[model samples]
Target chain A: MELRRFTQPSATKPTHTTVSNSEIAKWNILDRPLTRSREELYLSTFSFLFAEAVQYLQTRVQQVSELEEKLNQLGYRVGQRALELLCFREKLNRREIRLVSILGFIRVQLWKFLFKKSADYLKKVTDREDEYYIEEEEPLVNRYISVPKDFGQLNCAAFMAGIIRGALDSAGFTASVSAHYIHREEKSRLAFTVTIFMIRLDESVMNRERKLAG
Target chain B: MSSSRASTWNKLGDAAYAKSEKVSADLVALTYGSFVREIIKDFEEPDQVNKELEKLGYNIGIRLIEDFLAKSGISNCSSFEESAEIISRVAFKMFLGIRATVSNWNSEHNSCSIIFDENPLAEYVELPPEYTHSLFYSNLLCGVIRGALEMVQIIVECEFVKDQLRGDDTNEINIRFKEMLQEQVPWNDEE
Candidate 1:
C-alpha cells in the first residue's frame, strides 16, 4: 500500500482539518516512542485492544500449551527488550560471575520490573553464596483464573517465563527459567515461583572472567 | 528478522522502568502467549494459525537479543560460560525474578547442570491428571530457551523430571545439551 503523502494534493481537495503537531504526537501508536506525558497516558485507553488480542489468539489454537507458548514468546520479547533498554540507558554494572551476584540482579533488578515492591522477603547467605528468594504475596496476573481439568495443562504465566528466559539467554547464562505454582499448605495466599536454573559456567567463561577480573 | 521493533519495545520497557515511559501498570506477564493461545485455542482447524504464532515468536526472539543485552547489566560476555550466567540471572531478573542455579559440572567442565528451585509458572498451578509427566502449558519455556540457545550454537534438550506436588516432592527438571548441534533445529525444537 503506497502511503499518500500529506504534501500531495488530495484528489478530493483536502476536506479534513489540519492536524497540529501536538495532535499528531497525541495520535502516535504504541509501536512508536512514548510521546504522552503522565497525565495523557493515564487517560488513554488501550486495554480494549489488548483484550481483543488475547481473545483473538485464544480461540484459534488447538492445545492449551501451544497457546501459552505463544503468549510466553511475546512476553519474552517485551522482557528482553525492557532489560536491554534499561541497561542501555543506565551504566552497566561490572557484572556478577558468581551465583550470588546473579541472584542479586534478579532480586534487585528483575523483581523491580515485575513487582513494584522489592521482595518483602530476602535472605542472603555466605556459605553457598549462590541463592536468593524474592517473595511476592501474589503474582498479579494469576489473580483471576484457576486451572481446570481440560485446561489443567496451562500456565498463563509462561509468558513471564519467556521474558526470564530471553533475558537470561541473551545475558549469556544458558539459563532455564521455569514457572511453578506454590500454594502454602496453611496460608490462604498463593505465589508463583519463577526460578532461574543456573548452570555451572563452562571453563572458557571462568577463564574469561579470571582474565577480565585480573 | 528485524531487531528495530524489539529494540523499540525494549526501550519502552526501559522507559516504563525509568518513569520516562508509561504503559498500563497492570500485570503484563500473561498478555503475550495468552493472547496467542486464545487465538488458536478454539479453532476447529488450526494448522495455519500455529504456523503464524511461531513465526511471530521468531521475529520477537531476534529483536529480544538487544533487550537481553540492555537489561542484562553487562556490556558483553567474557566467554560462552560467562554468557550462560548472564543469560540466566540478568535476563531472567530483568523480565521476571527467577534465578536458575547452575551446578553438576562435568569433570572436564564442558557441560553443567541447572536446577529450577523456584518456578513462577508453577504458582497456583496444578497439573491435571493427564499431564502428570510435566507442568502443563509451560513448554513455551522449553521452546524459548531452545531458540535462544541455538542462536548461540548451544544444543540442549529441556524437560521436567519431577514436581513437588505431582511427584511426591521429588519433582525435578532436566535440560541437557546435545554433544553435537545441527544447523537446523528439529520440529520439536520450536516455540
Candidate 2:
C-alpha cells in the first residue's frame, strides 16, 4: 500500500479530513487479531516507563493510599483485559472450577503472561482457609520502583494487587488482593525487594466454590 | 556556530551519554505494542487511539525532557540543525539505544527527516492487511518528539512519513519547525 494513500495531510496543510465512519469501522482495533503470538519488551524500557508512571502519579496524588489507589486503578483495567484474552488463548473452561484452581491459574497462567514465569510460591494461609498467598521474590512491576523512606507502608505492588482483584472479580471469583513487602536480611544477589500478594476471597465466592465442588 | 561552542556541545553530549545495561529488544517491543493494543481496545476507534497515544506521549515527553536536559547537561541548541543532530545522535542513542540519521534537509533548513535503520518499538510489529490503510504503528515516537520539543520552547510539527512495519525501507519521522518561542519576563511594579 502506498504511504500517501492513508490520507495523512502534508506539512503545508493545517487541516485534514476527519476519519469517516466506514474508515473507522474498517480499522476498529479491538476487532483486529494479535499480530504476533509472542513478543517481548526490554525490561529496562518497561522499568523506565513504570518509573515515569509512578513519578507522574506521585506529583498528582497527596497520600500513600491515593498513590496506591491510582496504581490499582491502572492495573485494574489491564487485569480485566488480561483475564478475557488469557482465557480465550488458554481455552480452559470459562470459569475456573474451584478456588484452588483459580489461584493456580493466576499464579501460573497470569504470571506467565505478564512476567514470563510463574509466581515463586502459591500457599494457603495457615489458619485462614479463604486467604491465599502468591509470593514473588521480585515482582516485575516493582522491579525498578524504590519506595522512599517517607512513603511509609506504601507498596507499588498495590498495582499488581489491583490487577489480581480485577482478574478474579471478572472471572467470577470475587476477592480482595493486597501486596505486602517482605524484607529479607540475608540479601539475595538480585536487587529487588520481595513481596507477598495476599488474596482473600469473598464469603460468597467461597460458598459458590464449595457448592460447585460438591 | 563558533568552533568553541560546537566543541562544547559535542563534549557535553559525549560526557552525558552513558552505556546503561542492555535489555531484550523483543521484551520492550512486545510490551509497548500490547499497550498500544490495549489503548485501541479502550477507544475502539483508530483515530481516537492515535490521538490518545499522542496525548500519552506528550505527557511522558513533558517530564522526560527534564530528564534529558539534566542527564545531557545540554541547556540549549544553537540552531535547528544542531538540535536535529543532537536528537538523532545523543538523545535517541541514550534512551532507545538506536541512532537515527538527520537527512532530507529543506533548502530553508526549517524541516528535516530523522531516519531510523532499526526501530526497537517495531521489532515484532506487523500491520494486518485489513488495517493497512490506518494505524501508524509507531505514532508514539512522533508525539514524544513533538512534546519534548514543545517543552524546550521549540514548537515543531512532527509526523511519521515512513514506517518499516508498513514496508518502508526505513522508519522516518518528518519534523518541521513552526516557530521559535521568545521567553517572556515578568515586569516588577516597583520598577
DockQ (Cα-based) for each candidate: 0.04, 0.10
Model 1, residue A75: displacement in angstroms?
A: 1.5
Candidate 2: tens digits of C-alpha lDDT, residues B1-191? 35675566555555554434334343455446556765666677777777776767676677677778777777776567778877877677666766677889999989999987667675535678855557787787777788888886788888888776665667789999998777665567577
Instruction: Estimate every model's Cα lDDT from 0 to 1.
Output: 0.46, 0.72
CAPRI class of candidate 2: incorrect
Worst window of 10 by summed lDDT in candidate 2 chain B:
B18-27
DockQ, structure candidate 2: 0.10
> Tens-digit lDDT track for model 2 on A1-214?
5977777666766776875322433444454344334243334556755665566567778999898887776676667767776766667666776888888988998878777789999999999979999998888777777789999989988878877888888888888888998866665555455789899999999888778878
Q: Which candidate has the top score in DockQ?
A: 2
Q: Which digits, one per residue and each the tens of the lDDT, describe model 1 over residues B20-65?
A: 2223332233343344344444442344443444444343434455
Which candidate gets the maximum lDDT versus the true structure? 2
lDDT of 1 at A25: 28
Score candidate 2 by TM-score against the native.
0.60
User: Candidate 1 on A1-214: residue-level lDDT in tens?
Assistant: 3566645766768588865433332332332233221211110112322333444456667888776766566566656655664464345766556544555675567656544544444444235323233344454444444557787656555555665566655566544444445444446545444422223333554555567667
